[model samples]
Target: MTDTLTVKSQRRHLHPAALRIMHWTNAIAMILLIGSGWKIYNDEVLFGWLHFPDWITLGLYAQHGLQWHFFAMWVLMVNGLCYIAYGFYTGRFRRKMLPIWPRAVIADIKAALTFKLAHDDITHYNAVQKTLYVGVILVIVLQVITGWAIWKPVQLSALVNLFYDFQGARLAHFLGMTAIVLFLVVHVALALLVPKTIGAMITGGPKVTADPDTDREPLPSPAE
Candidate 1:
């Protein structure tokens, strides 16, 4: 009986509070940045998807889009930095997030797309989730670099020169935003498809039940 209890505790579902906070905070910040970004982008009507009035602007001046963009950029940067720090300190970065092997990652990706759970019987984040999580982090880093080029073309002239001058930076920035938007769309869709995922995020606990017989396992030590 004691052994069974131990196993149940080990298999208990848990997610760090820090991760949950960062996840929601990042979502909100992205929404704000995207909305404000669209308003700024209307300066030249870059995309025809949405329209904004020229006179009614959020920034001090029509050209002040850069100011708002920079302000929001700082929010994202600071939040991301904190997350990275936590990931490194806790070592959860390696144990939980970093895939054990390339084959594992590939298999996980396949499982995630097919909505199949692994041996644990819970469709927690399969391979695709891990890939996207890591990929998005890389995208954020690139966004920062391209953003710098756009914000300070003169200072970052060398970097901007690699892409295609200031024009290239602008294009990169647009693409980065598009990438996040696409990910968010798919993420939300998947969450709706699997309501348990949404609940898991909100509650910081798995919505799936573990089998008493086979699900018993030792809980990994908490990250130091």
Candidate 2:
């Protein structure tokens, strides 16, 4: 009982303020970008015969939506940089995330295949979660790169060239957006399935279990 208490108590500080801020910022930026981008597509969709419905998009008009999209793009870019820099400078990636071992992913997946895979503790993300997190970052990077390439093909000719042309960049950007939306769906679903994770992200962390002998709450993080 004592050992269990110690392990659970360790979750007192689940996410640093920096991490939480970046996370929610990125989420908001992504949502805005998606809505605005869909509206832009409604004007002239590159993909298929189907036009993105105007009703589902932001601003009620193509030009208005384009403006919003550009604004959201800037927000995504700046917030993304902060997220990356914070992860690197603070060692958040090394310490809290990507703690994989030989066959650990396979083991975790197999265990999760039983379909009760919700993990409550922020300190104990499984291999599958880590992999998904990494994937989401990569997708975000791709979105940024391709978005920049399309936004200013002439100014960013070098980036556009890497994708072969603006056409290629646009296609890649569209695919990146699709991937991101799908990931968001899975991410939210998992959060709902997990106990206290979404709440922890919002308000620092869940109320931890104190040992029976002590009625005191855990001390807050003294610094970021």
Candidate 3:
């Protein structure tokens, strides 16, 4: 029984099925929200000179965009909540994302700029990734608050007031959207640079061995 339990415990993957599902669900929801959001933004013209072309925007019209935006919002919110819960319950966040130090972040940033940042251990997140992931999570929460404020200024007047007013909330929402977009761009670029990460998300990467002293087997060299 002891040996059987040990073997079963070691049968883990870098990206578990639940995590992959939530990740892809969140990605699709984000894409839908961004496209529909651009459509809605074009209707209001946040910056008079800046407008997203209709061809790229979702929903085809402002009203339809609003509908799609709300639909995607629910999907994202539910999926995000599930992801957060799972992370906490499984201690994944604590293990993979905690104890981020500024010194490490700076070192990692420098290493990244110099093209020396290592990607051998995809199971662990580097400081730069930890910072970005936490920052983007906060941005998503901000988006939700500002979105509510803009959607129903009177009903959610407190949220609107927190941002200063209705237009303030709109501006906040726009900025949050910009942050998410920038994060996505960086995220996609990083995934492309380390293509195995993408494969891991889809296929769960390599099996993770459970041991008190270490987490994984010897990884192949980066050059391989």
Task: List the global CA lDDT of all models.
Answer: 0.69, 0.77, 0.87
lDDT of 3: 0.87
Cand. 1 Cα-lDDT: 0.69
Which structure is stronger by lDDT: 1 or 2?
2
Best by TM-score: 3
Task: After superposing candidate 3 on the true structure, give the runs of residues whose Cα lies further than 4 Å from its correct spot.
Answer: 210-224
Arranged by lDDT, best first:
3, 2, 1
Tell me model 2's lDDT, rounded to 2 decimals: 0.77
User: Number of clashing residue pairs in every model?
Assistant: 2, 0, 0
Q: Residue-wise lDDT of candidate 2 within 1-224, one digit each (tens)?
A: 46655556544556656778889988998998998988877666796786776667787787888888889888889999988877766556765566666487788888789985657556667888887788889999989889889988999999999998888888888889889989999899988887588888988784444333332224322332
TM-score of candidate 2 on Cα atoms, chains taken together: 0.82
User: How far off is residue 193 in model 3, in Å?
Assistant: 1.0
Candidate 3, residue 60: lDDT: 66
Query: How big is the positional error of residue 123 in model 3, measured in Å on the Cα after superposition?
Result: 1.2
TM-score, candidate 3, is 0.91
Tens-digit lDDT track of model 3 for 1-224: 46666566556888888889999999999999999999999988889999998888999689999999999999999999998888776667777788899999999999999999999999889999999998998899889888888989998788789999888898899999999999999999999999999999999998875553333322222331
